[model samples]
Target: MQTESVKLPRLITPLIDALTNVVVIENGAIVKNTLSETALTITNDMPQSLIDSLFQSDNPVVQHNQKAAEAAYTFKITANRTLEAPINLFIIQKDRNMSQNLTFIVGEHAGVTVNEYIYGNDGSTVDYVSQAVVEAAGKLDYHGIVNLDAASISSINRMVSVKQDGKAFIKTAQMGNGNTQQDTRIDLLGPLAIGEIKTVALSSAKQEVLIRSIIEHKAKHTEGLIEQYGVAADESFLMFEGVGKIHKGMSKSIAKQHNKGVVLGEKARLDANPLLLIDEYDVEAGHGAAIGQIDEEQLYYLMSRGLSEKDAQRLIINGYLHPLEKLLENDIVKKHIESLLENKTA
Candidate 1:
């Protein structure tokens, strides 16, 4: 654990005040962690059964990440307590391959929020896996940002389970300067459970980015929603895929999926795929997708106002992605996201 000092991303500067508890992972190992007085507990020790059960996926990359992890952290929030501050997690890879695993357990009636930042240097690769379990009546908010250099590659896999009356929100902002793939799945296992997944992805240069999210409703009165927005420029390729599934006997369940994308360069490509698989007749399920270029009229209108062409284009792109910032409650974080979007557009 080399804990001297590490360069932090600009997006995290606005969150310094609330970063009383911070975890830093470097080169696939835990380098430093600072904890404060709170209802949340962070530990590296967990039951083997729990770890195995949470990482049951058969994907080769998933198994590799689990087996290659040099350090793993589990965050447990006490029951009936609400965390007023968000936990910060930073993972950095420097010119090498790295893998890590994280787990979040929210006790019954408890509420917590977590922000994760994954950064990679040139020629580096990183695989990050996380599992979140929300007990009955518990609430969880998870946010992730992935930013890597042009020569790097990133893979993120996330799984979430919500119990009866539990709620979970998963939001992600992915900057596609390299090759990136995100796979997220949420399962509603008990009655009245709710799950939501929202993502904003930006790709430029020759980067290729893919985001896939799936929400499953397994109990009565359960609900699931998935929304993804993407932008592609400079010959890059971007794709957003969302799936909503309602299992049999899940009466009164609801599932919805929406995906939208924009293409900025003549050679850039964008794809949106929304799918719904419902096995219950009493459930309501729907899916929609839209993919196109920016509105030329809007660009013209902005340019006519004495703004440069690049400025006009950036403004329009920012407007398209602005809605994603509303999903967060903290203004500083929202501003950070806005700056990220602005930088990507520029």
Candidate 2:
């Protein structure tokens, strides 16, 4: 129940103003929370070595966010502890560009859930980076929603690691009339680790979006799943790239990726790429991608039920994105998705 707010001096005074808010609660009581510009205020029991390892990632987006970050938040769950409720993070941008970083660590035998929401004004830009690590037998569930105004830009990057017997689930929904680029990477670093990533995006009004995801299996008996769904309208462009890789020594590992997209307008464009790079002989890996316009048969069936063309199209799009909503498991997020769909259809 601890709430804190921070304001950072922007590099460009007239164009960007940085602001952040954070809240942390444990066992129905406020534990520790502070907001600052110069340093991250974290009160957690995780080891220093575990925190340092997250910064070693080589991803370009991660590097960019880290280099430009003006505010940071870190959350750690004690060993064998379970959070009663998910940690909620809300970020808002007014008229400026901003960069922020977030880190989550789940100790051995602990379980935690986190939900992040980002909203910004038109013409604004935001760069966000997040890293999460689940220790041996730990569990982590993360859900995110991005909603920026038209003409704005958002870049989101995330990295996750699962240790021995750990489980991690990441679900994201991106709904904006602006441009967005998101990259997420999951690493299975211990035996029997499990990871799942699901993302749904809706782009319209000349917006351009790129969603890239990678799942790496570096340990034996690991399992991973990646799924992406997107819809393009009004000349908007969308691209989805999913990559699954199994190291040479990783045997008995299974990885799968699926990417699908639908075009809602004649000028809309969609590109999907599902790739599997396996160096192990005893691994099971596969990928599939499908990009095309809405199914005419489905549309006809919906129209026959007395729905208008616009209504029918909306129904189709909803069906396509329904799976992602289920994965999100949040009523607020589901309402946001419905609102966005209404706007897009209007």
Candidate 3:
């Protein structure tokens, strides 16, 4: 007999129009083949100082795509009212010299789904970037969960843009300790556009994670997919770069990437690079990666079903981070990510 359920959080709505206007720029540049866009709705009650360009004063912190996560925050939206799910942003840095920068924008067919979590790492060490632009048949689902504890330092980067038959989905889950470091990225263009990205990471003692994923397939039936997984222990480290490209007159484009890693100890480490570039050709791209440890017949079938391999590897690394928290469509950001994964801290 085991019962403990008291879940109630599922009320997400936004899209109140008064026509719409929101423009935020700092440490900026948006002029490349510009169609000029800056709008927002939801009863147009803006002006929270657009996060003051993330505490401006010229943002910096580059080196492995850090660029100080510029803009810090310029949250915006447009398209009257209608957001039945997804929207929870939290960044907590309990003193010790903290910093910030965040940017968010939505327009076109206007649909929203976003959940971002970045817990403090003892301050003076947080650089992030969150960007999304999906118009046309607009749709956006984004979730980035990061938890750290130790000396400090954390870096995160995200980018998504799909016009035409727009649809973009991205997810990243990172948990670290032992002196942190995390770098991530994603990009996909338009034209019958569609994209899906999933990521998971956990590095114990002496942690490190560097991941970069770029999928750019412009036009003609564009589609992209990427999946990332990881687990590491003592002296932990991981680096992955999965890039897919198809330029000129991309026809019937298709791209794929997969990365996996598992290392328990003995100075754990992993590096994977999946890259494919095609100028033009009825495209079909591919990439797969793997780095491993921990599979003694799945830890002797979880100690012969008695449950104990440290709770069976923490139930297989939280079942690969519970499917991007079921693609959070709000529900109080899925109960604050189910109370931060039942207080598992990651």
Q: Compute the lDDT of residue 273 as modeled in candidate 1.
A: 80
Query: Which lDDT values do the candidates have, in the order given?
Result: 0.81, 0.75, 0.59
In order of TM-score, best first, we have: 1, 2, 3
lDDT tens per residue, model 1, 9-70: 44443454455567777775676677574788878843357658644676789877676676
Q: lDDT tens digits, residues 231-300, model 2?
A: 8888888899899999999999999998888987699989998889999899888888888888889889
Q: Please report the candidate that would top lDDT against the real structure.
A: 1
Put down candidate 3 lDDT per residue, 213-331, tens digits, no spaces.
Answer: 77777677888888788776668677777777778888888888888877777787878788878788787878888778867798788889899877777666566665576654335
Worst-scoring 10-residue span by lDDT in model 3? 10-19
Using all chains and alpha carbons, the TM-scores for the candidates as numbered come to 0.90, 0.84, 0.33
Model 1, residue 35: displacement in angstroms? Answer: 3.5
On TM-score, the leading prediction is 1
lDDT of 3 at 181: 45
RMSD of 1: 2.8
